[model samples]
Target: MKILVCIKQVPQKDAPLKLNAAGTWIHEDVSYEVNEPDAYALEEALRQKEKHGGEVVVLTAGPARAQQVLREALAKGADRAIHLEDEKFVQLDSANTARAIHAAIAQESFDLIVTGLQSDDFGAAQTGVLLAEILGIPHATIIIGIEKTDTGLRLKRELEAGHYQHIETTMPALLTIQSGINKLRYATLIGIKQAKMKPVRKVTWADVESKISPNLQQIVRLYVPEKQKRTEMMEGPAPEVARKVVDYLRTAARVI
Candidate 1:
């Protein structure tokens, strides 16, 4: 089983965000780390490799700083890595991002491809699905468990209201893993030393420009959400106050 886990580097969870002058994305001064969900995906891949005796390769598309995520994945247990390096890739829409990724891996053969459910920054859950569409392979999302089957694979997928569904599919498929499916493992000192020796292939934007699709989406503006507060007090008898509360719930809060 050859598994490819797609990882991403995003702003650290607690990093303060400041909009750029153009109001189109955050400043580059904040620290970054491997995306949380991607960590789970990598861990799941590592587990699969340990059990099935196969290679676990990781891939990421971003600027040079993005290599940090690949390095972390490698340190954890990935056999090798692929980095689509370019500043332009950082702003690409989900579709083009998927196209670039597909272009990069067009010649590679893998039994499965795994990715996080969505990016932490953009929260766009479309890239993995778009990649699956481009690859024309079986794809599943929110996968929690994976087991090898005689013919293919059995997967446990999450559903709303704390529900889960089991599915079966053949090889050469893709899946977007939800977070908390597995506990993440930290890179050991030995693994960190070994990761420095691991192979990390860097593919520049110019290398795959011809294969990339034109952008289908645009970001007109990006800004942080504003914070606001409001309060209202009711003064009257208990009965009147209770009636006011009910009316407020039915009108303003709309819980009823």
Candidate 2:
């Protein structure tokens, strides 16, 4: 089995965010790490490799600094890493991102392609599905569990309302793993030393542009979510207040 895990370097969730002067995306001065969900995806790929016995390669499309996440994945267990870096490719939409990834995979054969259900920064969740479509392969998104069978792979896909759907698919497929499916194993001292010696290949956009789709969308602007707060107090007798609270929960919050 040959597994390819798509990973991304994103701003740490708890880091303070500030939009750039042009109001397009956050400033790049803050710290970054592997997107949290992608870590689980990498772990799942490692587990699958351990079970089936094959090479697990980590792929990422980002600036050179993004190679940090790729090295981290290698240290954890991946066999190697591929960095697709280009300035023009930055800020591409989900479709373009998927296209770049598909182009890279076309150069090699992979039994399975795994990625996070969604990137924490974007939360679009469209890249994996789009990549599957481009590759003409089956895809299971938000996968919570996976097990290999003689003929195919069994998957548990997480759905709304705490529901899960069981799916079976053959190899050369895609899966977007959900977070919390497994504990991320820290890179051991030996693993860290080995990662430095592992193969980390860098590929430029131009090297694969012919295989890439020409249609690429541009982001007009990106902004930090505005901060707003509202407070309301319902004053009445205990019974009345309780009734109002229940109504609020049912009608206003609609979470119940």
Best by lDDT: 1
How do all models score by TM-score?
A: 0.91, 0.86
lDDT of 1 by residue, 125-201 (tens): 99999999999999999999999988999999999999999999998999999999999899999999999999999
Task: Write candidate 2's Cα lDDT for 72-190 as tens digits.
Answer: 99899899999998765667788888888877767799999999989988788999999999999999898999999998899998899988999899988999999998988999999
- Pick out the ten consecutive residues of candidate 2 with the lowest summed lDDT: 211-220
Q: Number of clashing residue pairs in every model?
A: 0, 0
Provide the overall lDDT of each model, using Cα atoms, as 2-decimal numbers. Answer: 0.92, 0.89
Query: What is residue 144's positional error in candidate 1, in angstroms?
Result: 0.6
Clashing pairs in 1: none
